[model samples]
Target chain A: MQDIKEILWEICKAPGSPGQEGAARQAVKAVLEKVCPQAVLNDDPMGNLTAFLGDKHSQNQLLFDAHLDQIGMVVTGITEEGFLHLAPCGGVDRRVLPGSPVDVYGKERLTGIVCCQPPHLSDGKAEKVEPVEEMYVDLGLSRAQAEEMVRPGDAVLLHVEPRQMLGARVTAAGLDNRAGVAVLLRCAQLLGGKPLSCGVTFLFSSREEIGCEGARVAAYQVQPSQAVVVDVSFARQPGVPPQKSGSMGAGMMIGTAPSLDACVTSRLIALCKEHGWDYQMEVMGGRTGTNADVIGITRAGVPTGLISVPLRYMHTTAETIDCKDAEYTAQLLAAYVQEKGGALDG
Target chain B: MADLKLLEELCSLYGVSGNEGPVRQKLCDLLTPFADRIETDALGNLLVYKQGKQRPKTRLMISAHMDEVGLIVTHITDDGLLKFATVGGIDNRILCGKQVMVNGHYGVIGGKPVHLMKGEEREKAVAVDDLSIDIGAMNRAQAEQAVSLGDTVGFVSGFDRFGNKVRARALDDRAGCAIVAGLVQSELAYDMTFVFCVQEEIGLRGARVAAYQVQPQAAIVVECTTAADLSGVGAGKQVCRLGEGPVVPFMDRSTIYDREYYELAFRLARENGLLCQTKQRIAGGNDAGAIHVSRGGVRTVSVSVPCRYLHSPMGMIAQEDFDAAQTLTALLAEHIAGHPAV
Candidate 1:
């Protein structure tokens, strides 16, 4: 087995916060290229990198997608006390800002902590937990020192390292879709040296944390007969309700949503059962909350199926997943591309 | 001092709603020695059962939430500032200029200084959208190295006593947790279930599962209700007053306490020579709101220590009110155990 932890560390450690995905794109691109050297690689205008494998003219074309970007913030202004004011680029939560460690990305990398005036200085006048707009990042620098280092447009991200936890779980800040990307790479690696009847497009999408822009662009360009979108789903834990999510280390989540192609989804679930693989059902009454939603509707509508690894702490620094789940998702994807029939289930 | 120390530790521990591992562990360690049977539910509700002096068909559940309101990291900016959202209900006003800790690192919440705000901005409170948590990372990668999206952060406030009042973050429920702990030290007349629930700040999350599983005939929810008896606030709207006594609210948004249990508490308080008071206003709700409706319904009442600035990092409470609430809750549990109305 490939050292999945090492692969995830390289992918997640890249600073790929929404629009700022250069490092992540470059890093994941290297992995894709290494895994499928014979595959034709291309990048769309939306920064969706695709590796084309197998025979392109085959009537059946399968596109596999994993978004590369994660949630982050944008620096909007600077305070006289050397603190930087920020705005959220995504679904930012304010309750977790106090004393958080961050870096001001600009001309220089300066380490700092998120702080405000202490209680002694506020005279009991501070309002209840302020919204994100009222928070700031203290660089531990003088006003002059801060202005010299940090630019207003720079981005900040969770300062965390990935770790191998007990029970074969891996945790980090940006494991949401990185876990998906890892699965995609593993599938490509599996199919690299094989002759296949169907074409496979492995897409590492960007700007997914904000929206499914990359997947949309790739879906339109690839114009495939079928697609499988991989992402992260809430894992059952202490606070989350059991019925609402799947347990981490249990199995992969096969999504059933209005936006997903029901036929393709059922076929995937049937495949899992036939193979005796660990799988769970996720019925999203509305949005599937992944790139599949946009890809399912792209260019005359492609049949899209969704697969998500059960992830704990979805958008938090401690986002976690079971390595076995990632490997299982890869095996399914690899088998999916190789299978041929008039219909996916057939 | 010893009792106050426990309250301080509970409030200081970072047990944000949905992330109550620390508080749960502490309570589990504390309760293991005395509890006859203890188990943690899927949602992290710690259920500790103690067989009373006499066996009874009806079981009494005493619940106090272990989770507190905090923030979760949503975005880390390129300039290394953190953007966040409140995990529970928090007024935008109390967020400016506060110290906090994420994971274990410390930072501050900063916004525009009053000196810099112009025109309309100065007239109103700053919108949360404009705030940022500066953790002193030099760049996006540097920040990402320490913090991660969705990492839970807590206020840096610690439990402290000044004069006759105690101030701390999470006193709203930590005070209640302390009360439950105090009750555990006393003898029970009937079998009792002590449930410390989670995610109450977001909703009555953990208590729902606990109530259904225990299915107690009667439940007494120990909580810390809002005490807005500050100067300039109207008397009718004060809701509750610190230093008076524990507030026994007749009704709140989530529930109306069992009429029989409501009247029983006051009668027992009088007989026991305890000073008990009714909440001046029907306002905030607690786990009782959920417990009363769980599994075909459980009879429930809420007894809260009056807390000022309920959701902020620094909530204030009267030490006397804390003591009184502890005494009253313990008494109510013993009463429910002895006199089974179920």
Candidate 2:
């Protein structure tokens, strides 16, 4: 309802590669400032930004977190043919790299194509995807010219424009997480005038794609009584099994884990049902693989829950999500914040 | 008297698997001054106790295993070579042509020189049976003087501190022991029982008995975990990193952590500003496998120092991570003492 596609477009376009997330941080900060002026914003040593809302004297603190960083690449070397050798900032599936166009962020923005030898040139084993080290990006210039435009340590983001597909499905690069960031922003906007009984800290963490490092620091710093980590879960797609993945456009996914606090989970499920929101449940036998992992064991430990937005083709260009599902996730969170105060404290 | 020097000395001592007398003695000597009561279990586990200010409703158990994976002498040849078998899980690939000391004795693991192997054989890992200990002795009698059948030998290595990290053999559990040692030296509010467990390399045999003896209501297993944060591994698969902080296992293959206790730790960490990360992958089991099920099932949580190349010689760990775990454990102990919830 709030031009969610446009918000997703702006966020998905920002170049934020793991440890270098300043640009994305600024972009998200601008949106958050406009929505929640009374919110307390703080950045920890690890570059995780948290915006606190509601009354500070509230007995319960509910932490809502979504990472602001996206998976990209770092320039490692320049080939003699003007190709840029790049190292992955996060887990970049090598099979997706060869034909992908990327926006290289250096002194100035440069466009490059990630390229490798074609099947006809090498042994049939060339079909077997090689490591990122064996791949390079071509910028269509001589080595000297390419070197003048880009240097080592430049960031490279996948080049893809956000597109609104049929109905509410949206497609773009980095939608695996920027959708989550967009949800946090939307939730903060909705909570502006609502009288809340609990203190809510909305964390726009950095470097979650690399490791849950930013959330780790922020969790230890905020030390909230309860935490809910909103992240992207693998969605059911062409090759993916529905048993292991959630369906896209099927609302939000709630995680059940051996690590997840059972009380928090039960309360969240009840809240979702009470508010008549579409939600699915995911059972994680071991690790939830989100900021919940760290937030669950920060100082002593904090009871944490995970809410996932189903995503297709994660950690790749053209990551896709359902806008309706994103909106329902934010609505569920806003409703949960209003209802979670008594249950969490008691 | 020197904690760092003692750590180096303890690390350098050779006592692998079944033959851990030298390491046990070193720990006993170091723990003697700090512990109010000290006793060794039948399985060679060092149980050190420090009484609290009041009658403890909960006995806090802290454990670190002493046994490290090494080689055991299976047969001694008439011509001074010793055939051995692995005492624990060892990647035989890294075993060929490495320096080793036999149960505080001078010896070296000997294997065929690279020049002697030909063609496809060079590509294959050297078999354990193809390796032996060479003490530069001519006959069985000379070999008997320095080594014997069933003699245990480990990588004779000293702890080396570099930048912010430390590399050594047996830091996996030795670092845990040093943390327990540090705790014993501090003024604790709870009745603390630190178990320097043995035979853990052989499937947590000592911790089972030690847990039975202490029967703590809550336990914190401070040990080392595998740090696979390196090149070539996917970011999602890098398990943990060095210097990031202590790797706390929310759920591992062995135990599902208590949710309340887990939250208690996270809350305290956030309050104290400690650096910590949750274990992202279900990989290995630890003493928590037994500690969680001890007696009526004690509530257990594990805080591990992330170490690279576990179960091998030259395990690397971040020193700050070890310290963070120590601080968190100490803080946890104090918290439990201040608030009796159980």
Candidate 3:
């Protein structure tokens, strides 16, 4: 099996601006083909990529979901000067946008730096965060050159490389859902070694950052009886209260919320206990803010569960997570699949 | 032309102000082969005396800073988060959500997610007091084991060139340093002194002492000045512009530059058919702030490359401007050294 860290870094490196997820979807497809050869792959019109392993005719199918899209900006206008006027495509953190470097996917791949005033140039009195639309991108190009090379609808992504930190921790710009995508990919790799008794469908949905549009449509197409959503939740960092987050590197966070099926949630917990794998409880009041909310009500309502990798600095270029937590998440997911496959009575 | 490869190497090294040992050492190694006499000053300034064929009538010194702005660890929190204070003037707007290196370990700066911020909190930038560097440590003990109270933190950025531009961290003075180093390697019209000063971002502390020690009759401070020719900013507010040319400031916040040398710079650039510009706004200062006032006064002028977003993680400069700055600095140095000013 490929090292999980390498797989995570490879997926995170691909740009997947929301609603323009072709690049990221291609990366995940290549890895899925290598990791699980027996699986049949399919792409829906809504931009969701799905892979089915085992008998597609079975009614007892298990669905796994992870969003492939990440937050980014799109070019809205080019100024009379060479600067690019932008509108963020997803929940791009305005606070981090200033002075951040970006990669513009246009007629050509152009490198740009978001415009910002250093304190020496500004009034130096009140510090304010500019709205995303107000900030301009400087590609170091002339006005005529910019218009010739770029259009209004090109995608722009934060250009931070995925880096390894101390131990198994890693940092990258698109770790929000790519971390979850890595978890699902690793889960498929583990499930490939065993005799699958139940059909499994992996859904790498699109555009979860703006809304669950892709998940809502893709889940209806997959039509699984039960589903599990793999995504990222807040990890304990400074200023974040401990109650609302899981400890990084502690384990996978098995989500418990009102909208989640109690049986799927408890079964994951029991499997964690049986396998002696590290785990944490991520409790939510109502709807877990994940694809679980949309995937649950798909076509007569599929029962869905949530598993999250404890990540720090979400929706920014500095999103970080521990690689071991991904391993823990994959272990719990593979265990759940095994428990469900045993019930097939083959 | 300036040595961009050297500039990239200089920018890649981490040498925040007050801890410029790494940058100073690199400069010393690069300049030693070209220098007749080189030694480090008390405040860590690398002073090199490159000998020419014949000594000129006027004493001359050309200088650039060796230090860049960065963060220093002030305290490690109970949860292993390292609190830091900016070593120089860094805007609070650029401090959040940046990746940094604390004592050679990879760390990231972040605060509460935007989803957790309240209405007013979202409008205002996160103050430096609220931000901390997370280096994947679990507790204070582990953080203390990895980092100390005074370890410096530098931004982690890659040097990249696209179109007619370059982007990287520490380009503020590294571009200047590369220009000066490149000059030291070339044949000079007259013998001169080259000082790569330290702690320029905090204040002109290093240049102050180096000027007092060198006591040259004339000085030229090579630097990277702010360029605010942005999309929304007005033309008057644009201190200088990239791609227009090198900048010669008649007056900035720190010094009223020598009128004769100031005119001399533009005159020489025009005569040589090189693009040159004057700083339109008197907003920034450089080592010229201190050098022009050292010991009965030195006739000093500043030649700068107009840079966008100075003191941020990634600063930008036009490749044409960098080459022009180097050629202009050399021409000004040679002419001033031969002039009968002393």
Candidate 4:
């Protein structure tokens, strides 16, 4: 069996910012092709890749959604000195931007650094974080040379290698959603080559960072009786309240929100208990901040549930998670799909 | 030409301020083969004397620091987080969300996630005091097993070359050290003393002591100074620039360099057809600060490579400028050693 960490590292290494999801989409497809080769895979106009398994004609079809896009920047303009100005493609955190390294996908891949004022030049006081629009990316090239290589609207991703930390924890730039994508791929690995009563369709949706457009469009086409969205949620770190976030290395976070299907959430919790697997409760008052919020209201209002792998340092290059959490999340998902006669009524 | 391969190897070694054992050991190994005598002082400075074809009329000393700016673990929180303080001048804005290596373990400096931050907090920069290094430890006991207090933390950056520029950590002084290393490996015209001093970042403490020990008649401090030629920054604020060759400063925040040596640097560069520039602003200091003020004072001038993003995880320098700094330092050192006292 392919390790989930290996799968996650491969997926996170691929750069896919919002509308530019081709690379990440292909990464997810490669994993699925290796683990679940019997499943039929296809893409939609919006770049959403769907892998279908089991009897497609079954009335009780289930869809799993995970975003393939990550937060990054797009080149907006270039200065006379060749520094490239940028606009955030998603909700990029301004605080962690200064002095960060990035990769600009231009005519060819070029390494760039976010311009940061050296302390010697500053007034030695805590300065306000500059908005991404005001910041520039230094390509270490002259104005004329930079213009020859890079252009406006080129994609730029914060460049940090996938690093294995102590124990099961790992950190990477695209771990925000790649962790979820890896979970779905592992889930497919478990359910592959096995007979199931209901059909399963895994949707590696695109452009979820900008909006839930990919999930919204893909759900309308699949029209499943029930859906579950797997994405990363807040993991407990310093300054984050315990009630608002789950602990890292704990387990899967079974999300409970007003927008979710209660039956599916309960079923997932029940399966975790039955299998002696660990999990934590993620309670939300209103809509869960995931693609589940959009997929639930798709078509004639499909009953959608949410599951998240606890992640820390979101929207930055240091997004971290435990590889064990992803494995357990996959186990819960596989158990949910394999339960006799998979159908949820809300 | 500057040896980029040597510079890359030197940059990869960790040598934060007071914790410069690894850097000192490496330099000793590289210089031992080419030295007349090699000895380390109590303060960990690698003092090497190289005999040449002829003894100089004036005793000359060439200096480059072996230390780089980094962080040190100050405290370990009960939750397995490590609190650190900057060992040297580091921009607080660049501390967050950066990968670091504390001792041998990989860790990341992070604070509250942006989604959890409220009000003006999202737009405000995090102070170094508020950040912590998380190495995936669960509690204080687990963290203690992996790291200890006062452990040096170095930024994890790999050497990269693109176009005419090279980027890596520790380029500030490592580039300077690489230039001196090249000279030590070559044939010289006059006897000279080379001192790779320690803890220069913490206040030029190492150079201060080394100068007192050597007490040369004239000194040449090879360094890498800040070049703020960034986009949108005004030309007046750009103290120096890359690809402009070596920077010879007249006066800075630290020392008013020797008049004769400062002029001599520019004249020598012009005579040799080397690209050279002067710092446009009186900002930033180096070992020249401490070395020039030693007992009875020594005539010292700084010949530096203009570097961008100095004291940060990644610093950039033009290859052409690096080559120029290396050649000019060799030429300037030879002239100073052979010239008679006026």
Global lDDT scores for all candidate models:
0.77, 0.75, 0.89, 0.90
| DockQ-based CAPRI category assigned to the predicted complex of candidate 4 | medium
> A212-277, model 3: which lDDT tens digit per residue?
999999988888989999999999886678889999989999999999988888888888899888
The per-prediction CA RMSD against the true structure, in angstroms, equals 17.8, 30.0, 1.6, 1.3
lDDT per residue for candidate 1 within A1-346, as digits (tens), equals: 3556667877877888787777888888777667778888887777778888988887888899999888888888887655688887765444445445555576765554454333322345644445567777755445687788888889887555565543456666678789998998888888888998888888888898787888888888999999999998887643356777886666899999888888888888877988889999998888777899899899898989999998765554556678888988888888787766224645
- Candidate 3 per-residue lDDT over residues B1-342, each given as its tens digit: 789999999998888998989888888888899999999989999999988877977899899998999999999999888998999888889888899998879998976777766787776788888889988777899888889999999998889998789999999899999999999999998999999999999999999999999999999999999999899999888889889999999999999999999999999999988899989887889999999899999999999999999999999999999999999999999999988885
| Candidate 4 Cα outliers beyond 4 Å, as residue runs | A124-126
Q: Model 2 over residues A57-140: C-alpha lDDT tens digits?
A: 876877899988888889998876566887878866544555445688877776654553322222344325556777677564
Give candidate 3's total backbone clashes.
0
| Decoy 4 TM-score against native | 0.98
lDDT of 1 at A345: 49
- lDDT (10s digit) by residue, model 4, range A160-216: 998888888888888889998999999899899999888999999989998889999
Model 2, residue A210: distance off in Å is 41
DockQ-wise, the better of 1 and 4 is 4
Tell how far residue B235 is off in model 1, in angstroms: 34
Best by DockQ: 4
Two-chain DockQ for each candidate model: 0.03, 0.01, 0.71, 0.77
Error of 4 at B325 (Å): 0.2
3 versus 4: better lDDT goes to: 4
Ranking by DockQ: 4, 3, 1, 2
